[model samples]
Target: MFRDRGPAWRQANAGHVSLGQLKVTSAIESCRRASLGGHVERSEDCVHTQIAYNACRNRHCPKCQGAAAKQWLAEREADLLPVLYFHVVFTLPAGIADIAYQNKAVIYDLVFKASAETLTTIAADPKHLGARIGITSVLHSWGSALTQHPHVHMIVPGGGISPDGTRWVSCRPGFFLPVRVLSRLYRRLLLEKLIATHKAGRPYVFGNQTPLADAQAFAAHLAPLRNAEWVVYAKRPFGGPEAVLAYLSRYTHRVAIANSRLIALDQHGVTFRWKDYRVEGRGRQKIMILATGEFIRRFLIHVLPKGFNRIRHYGLLARGACAGNIARARELLAIKKREDAPTETIADADKPRCPCCGGRMILIELFVRGETPRHSPAAPTRAIRIDTS
Candidate 1:
């Protein structure tokens, strides 16, 4: 399903993406070639060797996030503990929207930092029912309307440990952190960062074009944000381990809106469904129709800086001490490795088959790690994606 993306009739009217976006589009189109050990097999009669330049499988590349997600999940499977978890969202005020645009890399990074730090610091405080917590924060850059709306969705386990890190501290079954408290602190942290960054840079290099470019004007612009209630909503607890994985699957590598959500792209631009969060998500109530160029422009804004990791781990999952901490955590819980716990499976479907006998085919040779797949064929000419999102 990741392979075939044919140009859609809808994107026809959507034209002329910005200059900054061209390279990313090309990168997405060219990722994962046979040269990089991708699938490109030749037929029996072929004599000419084929050439396929492999894709640099980077997460920012829309084509590669899926493969990364699969590989990443395989590794994270070892990190999962048997615990119920909470889903918390941290959102920003639209007042900070313009500033975020001017400083996407830095501001986005701050969003991750502030949100994670807030959660970690608060959770660790003795007054707040302190305990070490595991959290997975995924950055989302777009709203359903394709706007550059940046927020971090955090999946935190329902409980944590004592401030001294001895015993587990559990929350009520339905609650995690206090939403009112999280929102108040999140707003303050973000506004402080926004003001600091604004003052640090040409803060108003483009202010001459704006009525709000002056210090007073900018201050006024940011004033309401001081009291604006930022949204920090917590969803009910997830069912269990598989549910958490399923939740991560949707969010961890999500693009603005999946091709599946696209309704139509026509003379008026593109029309897609977005949830009206202001109202209960009773139904897909709003239809956002955009000019094709504008739609492309909005989509391009989400492409992050090269190698910026949108998914992050905090607290116990921190890389440096993850293994030791997890071991200690398991011992505390008296959890032991299951004798029947599944190891990697070699699926029959993935095994080689005989062309002649319809029996399982034996591998006469194996390609070692540094070695390439055998008899690799040239990658196919670029195919058009008929699919749309």
Candidate 2:
């Protein structure tokens, strides 16, 4: 779809699109093609050969996330505690979402900071959990229907380490934190930061949002949101560490939409399946079609600013403290520790399998960008490549 209409769309929306989005679009269109180059692999038993092109590795590419998610999940496995995990979501109301769309880098970073602060502050209160907690937060910019719905999905352990570091603190079995309390604090902190950021001249407004460039107008725009009920939803506790892992696999590296959800892409437009979350039960799953240009636009809207980290760890799970905290938590829980596994790089991982004989396929040749492979995997059906490394 991008290859067919991308040029026209770019021309039409030239002023609105950013260079980062264009770069991602270009990468996705060229992914797994000869332009990016790849490797040639041959089956050990049969002389079957395959041409496996390199993935773009752009975070926004749907085809690129599977291996990335798998590798990331492997690294996070050891960090999981043998405890219930809570799923909490902090969503920006429409007013803030509009601003976020315009100033993604600034507003999105604020979202991360504000949300993290809210969680830690509330958790540390004596009346609440009263312990230092850890959280893994992933930001999702799009709703199921490809709308710009900015929200943060957080996976928090059901408990935390006591302030003194001498013991572990657990929330009630089914309850993690009060939603109303969380919602209120999150609203205050985020709005305060948003106002501060605007005053610092960090946010940019455009088109329909141009009026917000003025201080008074921006304040007025945000006034109603201050009183509105900010949504802070807490889902039921995950079954166990395994369930947490399963949930992480689904969301950690998700793109705007997966290719599997695409039903058709003819001239009529790009038809894809999207769930209407407002609907109940199975009826929520429905199909919708958009013009090729419109679909491309919506997809590109989620292309984040370059080098922005959408997935962040806070509190005990933070990079610097994770190891020590995890070890201490394990000690407090009286769980037996296992030997640490050696870290494996993508290249050191398992070899791809042969489609013909099911035997392992070994890398035979390497090619640089735009280079052609010497050996062609004649029967495309018999040539296999695993989307891992």
Candidate 3:
């Protein structure tokens, strides 16, 4: 799709496209191509040679997240606890999505802060769990159709450490927190922060949302949502630690849409599979087709600000004290840490081997860009060595 329509889209929407978006487009287009450079591998049996191009390694690119996901999962494996895990989602009202698109960094950060505060505060209340729960929150900015729907998915352990730091406190078997209580608190906190941010002259309102720049107008804009029920959905506890890993693998490094979901791409548009959450049963799994320009626009809207982390940890899972906290929690629960296997260096063990004879291939030569790879064997000559200090 990029090769077919990227240039025209750029020319038409030059004023709207961000440098980050342009860079994503260029990287995706050039990924795995000779333009980015690559390495040539030859078979040990001298039967075949293959050229493997380099990857862009951009987080937003659909084709570049496999190795990244593996590495992330490896790191998270050590942090997993044996307790039941709950999946909770905090979503911003659609009315705020427009403003979020214009001020992504600010609004997204606000969403994380407000949501985190709501969870921790509610969980810490004496009437509730009254424990300092750990939270792993991942920010997702796109809905099924690639719309600008910003939400945070949190994985909360079924229990927490007591306030007195003396014992572990577990919630009821099935329940995490009251949705009604969480909704009210989240709404209040988010609105308060939004109003404060607007007052500080930091909120950016653009396009048809210009009227929201005024305090009164902005307040009025948020009036309906003040009493409206905010959606704080909590799924059932994961079956086990393996289930938690499986779930994280799906959400942690996901792009707006995976390349596998793309059914077709042509001059007409890009057609892909999408789940319509509003519908029920089989009707929900439907297909959506959007114009190439529209598709690109939707995808780019989800390009988060550079250096902004989409995944964050809080409370017991916070980076500064997570290790100590996890250790303490495990000790209190009378749980022993699993001994990890001895680490082995696999740098050479995992190298690709000849498909025909299963023999190792050695690097025989290096080729630069625009230079043809010489298939001929090197001529024997006297070795001349140069020394530089």
Candidate 4:
């Protein structure tokens, strides 16, 4: 689709697209192509050789995230506690989401800070868990249909350490926290910070939101949202630590749409699958067709500001305190070390294999961009076998 419509779409929406988005598009289009250069690998057993091109490695590139997700999940496996984990989502109202589109760096950072503070504040309250909890928050800017629906997905353990850091304070068997309470506090905290940010003239307003540049106009624009009920959804607790890893693997490195979801791209449009959360059962999985230009526009809108870390850890899971906190929690729970855990270290996933013989493919030659390899196989092949491990 990009090969056919990319140039036209960029020309039409030249003013709307950002340089970062353009770079992402260029990188993804050139990924695994001869223009980016690659290496030659020969199979250990069968002498089967192929030219493996370099991936773009853009975080938003769907083709590049599979290996990243695996590596990330492997690291997170150690961070998981034995207790039940909860999946909580903090969503912005339509009003806020629109503003966030223009002032992504400021608004998105506020979303993380506001959501993290809300969780930590509520969990530390005497009425609630009254313990210091850890949080893993991931920002997702798009909904299933590739629409701008900014939200944060939070993974939290069902328990936390006491204020004195003496004992573990666990929630009741099934419940994590009151969604209504979380929603109300989250709404209040975010709006307050947003108002402050606006007053300080930090958030940028553009295009349709140009009027919001004025203080009065922006205040009036946000007035209706103050009374609106923000969404704070908490799904059922995951069965175990392993289940949490399984869930994170899907979401942590997800792009707007995976290649597997593409059904067709032709004169009709770009057809893909999207889940309608409003519907139930089998009816929820529906097909959507969008114009190539519209699809590209939606995808580009989700390109995050450069240097923004979408995945953040707060409280006990924070970088500085994570190790100590995990140890303390385990000790408080009287949990024993796993004797049956895998003893071997994780193997490097970069190694490719031969398609025919299923043996390790060793790198034999390297080439620069637009340069041909010194040695070519008897039967030259561009299709390098991908390792599924």
lDDT of each: 0.69, 0.92, 0.88, 0.89
Best by lDDT: 2
lDDT of 2 by residue, 1-389 (tens): 77778888889988888899889889988999889999999998998899989999999999999999988998999999999899999998898888888789899899999999999999999899999999999999999989999999999999999999999999999999999999999999999998898899869888888888899998999899888999999999999999999999999999999999999989899999999999999999999999998899899899998889999999999999899999999999999998767866654564577877888888899998968888988476644578997
Q: lDDT by residue for model 3 over 237-309, one digit each (tens)?
A: 9998899989999999999999989999886799999999999999999999999889999988899889999
Model 3, 94: alpha-carbon shift in Å?
0.9
Give the per-residue lDDT of model 1 (tens digit) for 1-389: 11232134225434644334555655555565533444322333433233234566656565566666666675777777787888998876676666666556787887888788888877877677578887889888788777867788999877776667677777767777788888888877876776776677534435433665566666788898888788888899999878888788778887776777788866676777888767775764787887666666677778776657888898888888888777777766778965655655434434444333345444333333245766644444454689786
TM-score of every model versus the real structure: 0.76, 0.94, 0.91, 0.94
- Report the poorest 10 consecutive residues by lDDT, candidate 1: 1-10
Number of backbone-clashing residue pairs for each candidate, in the order shown? 12, 0, 0, 0
lDDT (tens digit, per residue) of candidate 4 on 59-155: 9899999988888887888788888899999998998888888889999999999999999999999898899999999999999999999999999
Query: What TM-score quantifies how close candidate 3 is to the native fold?
Result: 0.91
Model 4 spans with C-alpha error above 4 angstroms: 338-350, 378-389
What is the Cα root-mean-square deviation between model 2 and the actual structure? 4.6
List runs of model 1 lying over 4 Å from the truth.
1-20, 31-39, 42-62, 202-217, 263-273, 279-282, 285-289, 338-342, 345-389
For model 2 the TM-score comes to: 0.94
| Superior candidate under lDDT, 2 versus 3 | 2
